[model samples]
Target: MSGVAKVVAFMQRSWWRAALVFAVLAVAFVVFGRYAVPPSTALTSGALALELVGTRSGAVAVLRAFEQQHSVHAAWVSITWDFAFIASYVAVLVLALRYFARPGEPDLIDRTAAKSAVLAGAADCLENLGMLAMLAASPQQPPDWLGFAAFATTVASLVKWVLAAFAAGHALWLAWRKLAQR
Candidate 1:
């Protein structure tokens, strides 16, 4: 098999593994996410964002819970969480960009891939900015409950969904493209 053929075969074969990993990760997050998050003085962004947000439970709760469990200060946890969040956001963004980036030598496939990558990269940036804004608003000032709600819904949830949608769209597009090529 050609390199591209091999890559495609690998992806097809491992698709179930990918889905399983995602499922397991989701379960793990549901179990441990509440503990991993630090107390929030502000709103959440990035992965914390949701499409259907409830004003009742949110990032602040998770953050507080994590801090209490770990017996650490919110201040310290915030710093560590901030870095980890940023790193995760950056890593996703880079991967998203590469999804469309390798347009093969001026060919249409290359161009299409490049466009997907660029869009994914842009999504990553927007996601990062949203996350960064949340991080910025979180420190020192005690967060207004209304502000947290808004941040959680608008900045956090909206951004998270947008990124997910983009990723899903790219995946479908790539699959179709590959199949069409075959």
Candidate 2:
């Protein structure tokens, strides 16, 4: 069998493990948000405002807001913690997609959902890097590249959310159907 088939086989068998890890990571994510990171108004903004601040001015404003609230370090910590969360979520989603597949063959939707999970992870990584870069730059007198970084980060964040939602929704729907049949 091909490498892909081997991986699918492995994932199909390890779905429970993936689900366990995902549960742990989800709790950790919440803990990090609540305790590890300091409370701040900037951080409490909606997801899009936090991740999709597309314009340079908007990015600068966010940075300034964090600084003013004395939560820049908290923002950094949150982003760092998110890296691990991304891995866990992607793994769980992919495994869940594979779990719904036939013994040796994944249907097109399953394959697509798995691929979307991976792509979402990649996009999230890009968005985190861009946010880090923006944080590194001076929000007051932003660098020329800051605008591009903001735009790119916004795009990546958008892609990540869309793909992740699709993958997660598909997996949940499949699970729901399975449960209903049982």
Candidate 3:
């Protein structure tokens, strides 16, 4: 079979595995957030981080605060865990799109949804890298590269969400039409 066909077959057969993996990763994220990062911080959105830090000095201050909270190790661990989360999230989301289109070939809505899910995961990985860079340099002023990282993170994040929204809307519309045709 073609690679695409193989992937579709795998997704069709193993969506539940993806779901289980996603659930474990989700729980890990929540636990890590509670102990190390705030839920808002976990998102790793550059705009949101800048809003929290306010300025270079603010970044130092916040890092100090995080240190004082004795959550630094947990925070670092969470950063590493993010990779697993990203993989699992993408798998689950993409598999869900495939599952939704099962018993037939995927139409445009399913194809779009799968593509959007993959894009969102890629964007999220970029955002996580940006956050890790900042976190690694915490308690010190961020480098000039932070600006670029932040810009990339913000733009990618926006694109990811918008595409996901379009996918969701399409899914809903498609579902409605299917029901109406019955």
Judged by lDDT, which candidate is best?
Answer: 2
| Candidate 2 lDDT score at position 87 | 74
Which structure is stronger by lDDT: 1 or 3? Answer: 3
Ranking by lDDT: 2, 3, 1
Tell me the TM-score of each prediction against the true structure.
0.36, 0.81, 0.62
- CA shift of 4, model 2, Å: 9.5
CA deviation > 4 Å runs, candidate 1 = 1-60, 71-154
What is the per-residue lDDT of model 1 for residues 1-182, given as tens digits with 9 covering 90 to 100?
A: 65433433443466574455445545554444343364453323323432122332454444444444443244344434444443343333333333323344335644454344345444444544443443334323436663454354455445545555655465556647755775
> By the lDDT metric, which is better: model 1 or model 2?
2
**How high a TM-score does candidate 2 get?**
0.81
Candidate 3 lDDT (Cα, 0 to 1) = 0.59
Q: In model 1, how large is the Cα lDDT of residue 169?
A: 64
| C-alpha-based local distance difference test score of model 1 | 0.43
Kindly list the per-residue Cα lDDT of model 3 for residues 1-182, writing each as its tens digit: 76445555654566585466447657765654454334544334322553234345555555566666665555566666766666665655564455455367787767878788778778767766665665677465567765565566566657767776765565555546655765
lDDT for residue 167 in candidate 3, whole number 0-100: 58
Which runs in model 3 stand beyond 4 Å of their true positions?
2-61, 165-182
In candidate 3, the residue pairs with backbone N, CA or C atoms under 3 Å apart (3 or more residues apart, or in different chains) clash, namely none
Candidate 2 local lDDT, 90-180, one digit each (tens): 8667766666554556678888998999999999999988888888887778899988999999999999999999999999987787668
